[model samples]
Target: MEPASETPTALLLIDIQKGFEHPTHWGTSRSTPSLETNVASLLSAARSYNESASQPILIIHVHHHSTSPSSLLHPSARLPGTETSAIEAADFAAPTGTEPVLTKNVNSSFIGTDLEARLRGFGAGQLVVAGLTTDHCVSTTVRMAANLHVLGDAPDGEGIFMVKDATATYSKGGFDAETVHAVHLASLDGEFAQVVSTDDILGRVFR
Candidate 1:
């Protein structure tokens, strides 16, 4: 196993927001198990590794926000008197001081956000990515990872590493789940990112 600090890896947890409770976020009308279990397991595994690792894991949680009128994700939206937004507290379980959250309006975490700068600040060369909608935010972030240059002038760019089981997508969307899931993995594997699993990742860290 590579030394943790020397490895320069970070976990990219994207769009785990509570607003996804409805299908509107996925261009649908209802939610599915994708929002509940798969991503939850990944988060648990990540937190476990963080607790035991010699070097603390750097977690960058990406939240989606919108300014568009009538959009549920609009910046003016709220869940009542609470300061918590759906993106703020939903499906969130980060060890205090370990995960720094980044809010974004775009699908790609690198686009219109401080994600790239924050990743470099944490010295992350490899990214372990997980989150909602296999066809959307998760996929977009992975794509951006492949082209993200450490410095625009640098020859080689930092690559994206995707955790397959760590991600989930709603089943009732306009697209078919089996086909959409398979295609995303196939397209991402090798060309843009390396598709992996939660166990595959934990094995590297634990043993």
Candidate 2:
């Protein structure tokens, strides 16, 4: 479907699936308890970003379908009649009619999916990305979006937007989840993305 915004910015939600919904899935620990809620709010704000505009902001869901049989995200791992499945999108961020749902096995959404083409098709020059794992898939997609120059080449993920509170990550090494999350945001801010909060995005980008 065509974008409903004059500016035509795309909201790219990466790996916002049931697989990583709870901390138990990721060693039972994660940083942001409000990640899903923040993203949901973002989605709502983006959809109604410009109510009077002819077109609204385009929405794209990037799902991670793991090819590895042992991985939870793999299709086979999601058994029938289960309470939740790894591949299913979270309730708050599920795609609606006509919204594009791009699946990928790798971290970067642009790697093997038609995400780039879809963005180009929708004529969304700017991208606002939010989803799972600040240092993993989210980081990879942001870096790729900057390097790919979809929003023009200035390097250091200048044109793209990354929601700080809307993304989360698990603890690893000697660090805690909070530190890991903070560090990733700091690393990506300016260097890989704008890294703004959900409220900030709603106020600025949508406005």
Top-lDDT structure, candidate number:
2
TM-score, one value per model: 0.77, 0.89
Number of the top-ranking candidate, with TM-score as the measure: 2
lDDT of 2 by residue, 1-207 (tens): 123343568888989888775445565479888897899998888766645656667788989999888777887665334756768888899888777899999989998898877777776656888898898999999988877777654565765888888998998887888899999889878776897787877776776
Question: Which digits, one per residue and each the tens of the lDDT, describe model 1 over residues 1-207?
Answer: 243445766777887766655544555432234434655665676667677777666777887887674555666665545555655546454434657778788778888888888877776656778877677888888777776663233233234557777676654436666557667878888867778766676767323
Error of 1 at 49 (Å): 3.3
At residue 25, candidate 2 shows an lDDT of 53
| lDDT for each candidate structure | 0.65, 0.80
lDDT of 2: 0.80
**RMSD of each predicted structure:** 4.0, 3.3
